[model samples]
Target: MDWITHDEDVWFDFRGSSPEQLTPGRFYKGTVDGFADFGVFVDLAPGVTGLLHRSELDRRLESLDWESGDTVFVQVKNVRSNGNIDLGWSIRQSESEFRGAHVHDPDGDEDGERIEADDGGPEPVRKTPKGISTESRATNGTESGDELSADATAEQKRVEAEHDETRESEAETVEPAETVSAEPDVVEATTSDESAGVEQSAESHEAEGTPERAAAEDADEGTEAEETAERTEGPAAEPERVTVESLGDRTGDRVRIEGEVVGARQTGGPTIFEVRDETAVVDCAAFVEAGVRAYPEIGEGDVVRLDGEVELRRGELQIETEELTELVDEAADAVEQRLVDALSAKARPETVEPLADHDAVAAVTEQITDAAEAIRAAVLQSRPIVVRHAATADGYVAGAAIERAVLPLIRDEHSRADAEYHFFTRRPLDDPVYGMDAATNDVTRMLQDNERHDEKLPLVVLVGVGGTTDSLDGLGLLGVYDASRVVVDADAVDTEVVEEASVLVSPSLTDTGAADLSTGALGANLAAAVNADVTDDLSHLPAVSYWEDTPEAYRDIAGGVGYDERRTRELREAIALEAYYQSYQDKRELITDLLFEDGGGLAGHVSQQFRKKLDDEVATAKANVEARTVDDVDVAVLDADSYSHRFDFPPTSLLADTLSRRDDSAVTVVYATDELFVRTDADIDVRAVAGAASEAVPEGGVTAVGVRQNRIEFLSGARETVVDAVVDAVVAQI
Candidate 1:
């Protein structure tokens, strides 16, 4: 039999027996047995080997700094019917990284104690009824499969009795073991002999406490506990098993919970263990002499039984653990199965066909599936989800759609009234790129939460925004701390952005154009996949995104739900106004009231304001435009710095959009002192125009500022020259 050693206290025999001990979704430490073109083979145990596929590697497979015979960490992703195992690459590569790591071998004789095979050497000292026996079992050492002589069997029984005693003391309810009286005081005599070898005799302990006296006292406590369990084994009733969800009702009451240990972190006082049952997840805090590891053997992914009193700690529900037992056999098997089944049900949605009605949506079916799974996993893991979207009508509608879908599920899953607020947050971005400003804010908040509250980092989701390479640095900052990311966009983006995100939903990857598809429509479909119950409510959102060129299919969907053109426009207007007022906020409740609530007349009132404000600004802007034909193109140029109301109601972006829609111009350019906004029927790279203008009129100090809005900033003194140069550049490009 071959064995592997983990430090001085742990040894695992790789000579495999039962395959049942190896379960999927569990992390394992294995040696890199071999490698192939497709993947690497890892020997979890001797017979229990798994393949780490190349596709699962975080980096290129060739870049892996691992060699055969080196120890590595891998996750069991799947166990095939043919008895083969599929492994996923783990970011953590060491034992200390995981909460609990153990060699799960059911065949071990003494409850899987870390033991090594005997080599040719002197037999170790053995304990007996009368004294310490320096016995050599060399004659019978060659026997296999944990074979024990008469003396070895007695020692094994003594060790088992000690364990039973430890368990009884921990549980604190079982009766004393009767074996303490039935069996002679062999443990005491053995300790006495060992101490006598040091010349610390019984007489030496009469005046003062000797080492033998202290040892005797410790043995007495074990003797008392062993006697308790032995006497109470049959009559004690099993504690009632409870789920984490039921813990709310069981506050101030003692209950037993069975769950998988998903996370474990140590605080100054208590070791907090995040345990998740099928119903929900909760933290269980165990304090053992402050700053000590409460249960060192229990690691993440281990199924165990915990007895504790539910209590409110710092306004949060936490379990005060009394007795935690790492389970085996039927109890462990049952818990593991329940967790796996629940995760499977939550991770995959039933259908994505409703979202795939459009060609663009259909093309990114795989991406949609991945995004849905990542969102569901985040919910299941109880990680907070942060959704960032552009501060446009389309982006607002899209962000709200996801909010509508996820909020209900959070409310249903968690017992706390404030769970929705804590678990989900949406932020509006003025720019499409998740740039430095946004990343700095997120990192600051996340790091503070992690340090002050022991909270897990959030899953940052980008809708309508983070699909461009410009957002790479922000995403990279989040990744530095192992935060997950998902991007859902109806815009063409670079491949690097797709690869940087954990999950990306974009049609461009499938060679489909997303120009016609509204971000609201894409988000609605994703929201449906995330929580199908909200599908009907979100059906009208796609139609609301488009002020012009509204898709017939989406309009029909809105119409079917009794949201006529008038109601749709009203909702859209209301959201746009709210978005302007709270450009940085998600405005979750306010938007929810406008979109999903009944005839409260809220949207109508807001929409009226939206119309009045916009109509006034558009009216003023149209009158001030210097309309002209620049090579047969109807160009409307407004000196936004003078005529346009810069600090008032309708923003320049909205004003520009409204003016462009009217017959004022084929292209609209609103110019402020240092900034310019461009809106046109055809797509134009405002950045390119700025570059050309800067090169053509060097002193203009022109540069593209907002990529998403197609805006540029230039020197006010060189305004005319910069404007002429930009107009010429645009004419040449078009």
Candidate 2:
């Protein structure tokens, strides 16, 4: 038979019990000492230990099967100057796996002798361990004839005598290993050789009378016995499993939990796994190395069994994981079923009633319920939610109401402290239509996140937008990727959007009176349906959405919530101003503070800036207003590009709305270089006017951008012609 030799097929046995006797790059037998947060400590010899970091392990640190005092195989990677040993994992776990072995004597020879292969294989390499005593290696045939001093020889003799005495005492105690159990302080050794070695080491310690060493030894022996029993007698009884919701009571107690992993994130110190059970969600922390993922095989959506100790970290419950095992077959199915049943019961509200009694709100109650359930389900599944709303006071209030309701649910449903920011987002749209520009950006981001982080595509909630024909293309783009879209708009919606949207809540689609309806009112009710716990906080949002003719019921609700008429007005104006400045940003914290906190102090300060900016813009436009009479109707036209601050506060549409309020009977048309805004009290279809203008001036490329806001865009070269045609079209409709 032929034999082969490999580096890993060799093992080292160090006879001396000292740190200096260990050699790097050699495989050695070690006893498991204990565990730590980062790694396990292994003892090569008595008082000589090495650290096998979790990063060096082939599996998660918590998944290691070795127990204290059990023999483990490890490779010495390095020996630091400070006497610290860094160890690496070895595949071979038993002495029988090695083809050759070496016995290292620290006091005998410079190069330790290697034992020959058991079955006549190639000779193994010879390597010396460190710390060879010069006094023991000194020879009489030396050329220099150097001799040891009297003091050195005397010290060596004394050390040898002590060693002999300690060995003799250990031999005497070897037979009575089982008798040591009577003393609670000392542990019984597993074998005679181990018993002698432990006794000799323990007697050398100054604190020999203490039971600490014995206790440690006993734990190792007990673990070995238990493992042996498990192999021969089926398996040991499992620990009691606990639910995530019950973790608070089990703080500092090691527990076994079964759950679905909703999310996983790698932080600076540990990899955090957000586990969701039937009752609730909790964060389980598994550390391998700084910034390194703990278990690459485990990921979101996996059903797993986790063993960990519960701890309260920074006022939040966290589990420090000891072992994480993925479940499959029947076990996984059972856990997944439990989570599904709980999620279905908790995600949808039992009833979704309108916040206030209005015919339009009542008509869309079912649709609102569906939208709310979808949003709630998204949260429970750990899916990201992206809310797109118009950049106006009413739009901000609509989006903010939903934000206020969903944030708390996110915090409650996820263990990560930053889950609210990660799972929920509100983006302001410059235009009310969910156009291709916005859709492309959203799809790009979602795809990147899905590819890089393994995240689910977000639930795109279109508030006060995505309910018209103009948004059909954009909504269709999202549908191509199977992204969920919920449209909640108070404005008239095209019948086509009903098919494109996953859930549509619009008064016009239900054929009800929407004159009294505001997007904020619809959004607030939907928010309440999503989370009824925050219903009190959202009662005032509808009142804030309106600039005029605030409903009596909404006003009462606002007043009941301590937001009187004056305070509501101040908040609306403040949000309107802030909304215009950073039209694209959510400004989540600032808006939350103004709407739900600070008791009107920040709103008051911000409202002042709103008034000053609006007054200045209106003043500048009033001086250059051009008046015209089309078919006996008073029409006020302003060259917004030349007369108004084009890039500043008071956007063209907002300026037109404000200027139209000056004469409710007259029509206000604000025309920029390539676009126009129309504001009037008369019933006029802006899209109709744009269509008529496009026909009147075919080369101008006139088109209606937003019918709700009454905005039109045209080619700049035909700006003069397009403006005249738009004015004529508006007059004909009036």
Candidate 3:
């Protein structure tokens, strides 16, 4: 094998130019010279034979349809000394798909496929491959259910491996399986003698991966995606090859084209239809209107070689072909084209819907949440469900209780948080909530006098409720209180509440009794769900769980969140996020209500307990509100308006967008769930006018009203109930 110091700027040791130097990404059509369980080897020219995997042999379809002498188009992948080459194939019977198939040459943009990203894109064209991308199916596998699914799960990602911009670095750092490049650095295998004294290949796995395990991990959602990292190969590997030469109307040079056959004449017309490259696809009319030339029989997955000038016919990439060849390299190429056609034929690219790409964390969170939701749904649907929530006791914290109540419905073990207090207390509760009362005047007074705020302002939010110690019921109010305190603490903490802190109002049994967490909250049925849109802030926070009960539990993880059942932990996190969302949204509304309204912020107020406060500090507040009809509402509302929030962060917004805010100042959603009851020392019949929502919010939906604020409270119910109520509330008149 000697280097060819010939006219070509290519280098070769012996078995032809490398995969990098192959033209049109294909060597040429060859015949099967050998067959093995692994694949069928095809002889291209003389010294080269390409491989067609056994996997490519259609089991359900007719094998007789394909013969040894069958002329196929193929692109050369790896060139083995023994003349073994990897052949790409497709069983698609479509003429166009057959004509356009090519190998994995990076020179031009004959890419693999597009993925279902979370970021919404315009609807796609091909509708065949459900949950599959047009781009990927177009260039990879066949779009049958079994094959498509398998492809999604096992196909190797071949793009330039680089995290997309959507990969938010500031997000929780996840150990990436393959972060360096698309093609993992090759490692040579070493042989070792085992028990039988037989030689075995030992592939010392790298620090972050094992192909099997990694593959499984990626397949969790059927598809793993990386941005299209350009790696040019094939004839177009060099930009010079992509150029087309218009040689005196006959033989052209440097022309690269991709397309499907619309019409192939056994003798006359040039293949009709189109040829697509990187930027755009072009419609090319064949030049052989001459004597019946082999009908230019271009089948699907066959790469049409355009040896003539590239004429842009009405904005289309129309190439006149002097030669026609099949892209018979890796069988994957043909499969991909057929898959694309099937997908496109199944539907149009415009119809394929774009999906939102979930980040690792978001994905994990979504899975967990979806599992929880599934459990909740099954229980409520299949079986009789009475979602439980408590006034004070019963058995559960906002996150943990819901997790327990619905655990039975879930077949997967990952839905549970694994531990109660530890995980739930991450953003724990604190401070005994003390409010004036939800009266119009008090809310108004509180809103106007933004400063001199006391623990007894119209609303006082308790953060994280502590974890359960003894019986679940005993952990109710106190637990809610503890958890509440934990949630409100402005600073991050790392301790779990060992006392009866993780309690909450059981959504299950309206019965206000201690809880029984050990039973997993079954039997008595459960209650409703908390809102995910709320933004209530937390206070007196406790520490979160740092370590799990077992060490080996998390052996499979790279960054264990202190447990082996990482999936379970993920589910817990998702629930917590939803709860947090509800609480946050609730808080935002409370603030908006307290600070606005034409009737004057807090247009109504009649809290007996707060009345005492009014009597106690009425003078100080009146003095504050007296100024400017006083823009107390404007002042208080404006003070905190500088911040932006998100249940869904805006894509265009900066990453630093705040989830919670206080500015060391005005209003905040410090804990809205009844996990911790915000109480007023004084009890009284408080009738407060909370805008027009007063009607929409049924007396029952308003679980616990603020002892002081005009319209602050907790609202929870069955998923459907809450979803409907929320939708209605949001769609309410401006």
Candidate 4:
């Protein structure tokens, strides 16, 4: 038996665990998805996939109609991690077939698909009865095929099928109800037609692929469960077998933990990385005994299922590995993970290595980590993580914890979720999905540092409390935004999808002179302040309207730095364009990849959706201004993702001062990002100019022309008309 150490143990001192001798194939046992049809996918061990084909689903199932969601019962087959093994097994087969014989009649070898080839070829496929096959034999060779006991297998499969049919006929007397609530409920008792009709009101369960038999079983005349048993299995002296059920809620002997992966932590010793699944992170030590690298690879966002004893390790409840594996068979999850992974790589290519393309949760964790840090710093400094909230005064907000503590005076979470701000964090990060110690700590630090000095730091925390859930603390960081941040805490709300962590500024500076707010300086400021450089002439910003437009009006409201509307619009457009490109590019890639699955060459469904969306964008570019810009740049309506920026330094300047990042004396930014930018007087057109752009292009098939009201459209083939209409509308606005 594999024994897991308690939390207090040194072994538990590690953030994760190493593979032990006991936690392998036989160690993992799970109830097969009893209702599974076609195939049953299982994890015989961590990061392993085993498939039980429909042919082995049941003796009766092969010839019957099977639907997609039908679940079944399964267990680990022989496991050789280094070598692949057919991972599925079944019961309910003929005795001969179960003994490793072909289920097809030798005389009927008309197709030879089920035959042991005369020449060296695959062994005739055989079925099993005990739901387990302990033998190991080559699946190929004529020598292998000549050694056969399978004539019985073929006869048995046919017998099992016929017997099942007979039993099903008798079972009609029994009332049809929900597909077996569980495998265990199919009892040995027989039910007859009278009792079923009189009491239970037997409803017909249309078994898949089953045809109506003209003569009903005579045994079904009376109501009895044993009668149904006879109907299903024929005249069996043995009782019907009971299968284990999946009681969704675990009040029994086990606990089911489920969640997304957010972050990874490492102890001082091990080289293995932690696999942070959402339910809770677990210790996955690499395996070295098999002469293979243990902890070979582990990345964030891997979906996992673990059945282990709930042990308290260092005050944390973690499972001590009875069973665990990455869930990779589901198509939707796999696709989502691939997109997020690609995005994360593009966003932060340096700090982390690429995790598997299938771990979506892991990539999102990385994103949360990045976004949270930016917001944390902005809030810690005097910058507000601004956004457009309908009823708030500031028009932006902070983490929930900050909001609750500061809202008594500030009164809003405005548009924080969508604003530009810097975020900061402590090293070796730790917290729940929303993060820990720091969500509130940054604000606390600001207050304390200010209090110790009493003149500079004014603690103004902003939060979003209206979006509360059962798991949320009234004023925690998670309450402000649902987007998860990278942290280890399970109690906090930061690991979900609706909110994010950020800091809100009340814009309290009353200075009537000086440049006021430093553009793109909040993150560096906090970093500097924490490092004891608080006197950097960092001007505080004045409040401005969420919908305010134009540099002059912005300046009038700000009173110090002129509102950089051109810059902000430019930035906004860039951000939109970048986001749009990401969306569409991923669509193109996914579609392109679909042509490869099982030799498919067709575009994927996502690609179809993206193309359709682009076609629509071409048709309605002008009126739908926000949707028109990829972020801000308008390109050929059909290929907005292919649009390149033309504004040069122009669009780069339309951002809020708080959004740009400062190194020392200079601020730097990518033009097509951030929906707002700082407009330094520049000659470049903020949007694309068709006359100039077309002339600039070397003679091409179709040239992209101009920008209108921040919308960019292009000239092309059939796509040109749509682009023309959209660009024409926007150009009229400009």
Question: Could you give candidate 1's per-residue lDDT for residues 323-356 as a string of tens digits?
Answer: 6777778867877888878777767887775643
Global lDDT for candidate 2? 0.75
- The candidate scoring highest on TM-score is 2
TM-score for each candidate, following the candidate numbering? 0.62, 0.66, 0.19, 0.21
Which residues of candidate 1, in runs, are more than 4 Å off?
A: 1-272, 277-345
Comparing 1 and 2 on lDDT, the stronger one: 2
How do these models rank on TM-score, best leading?
Answer: 2, 1, 4, 3
Query: On residues 55-78, what C-alpha lDDT tens digit does candidate 4 reach at each position?
Result: 444333323222322322243344
- Local accuracy of candidate 2 as per-residue lDDT tens digits, 1-734: 53555556788766665666687888987766545424566767654666676557785443455545466779988765545567899987766678767776687673446765444322232322111223333445553324644553454345336434531111001111111111111111223331111100110111111122222223234344445666899742344577666665666776777888877875423457878777666777665433346678999889988876666543456776656788889878988998888777877789986777878888888888889888998997879999999999999999999999899888875545788999999999999889999999999999999999889999999998898898989999999999999999998888999899998888887667588889988889899889889999898999999989999999998999899999999999999999998799999999999999858889999999988988888888888898889899888889998988889888888888788876543788899989999888789998899999999999999999887788999999999889889889988987
What is the C-alpha RMSD, rounded to one decimal, of candidate 2? Answer: 18.2
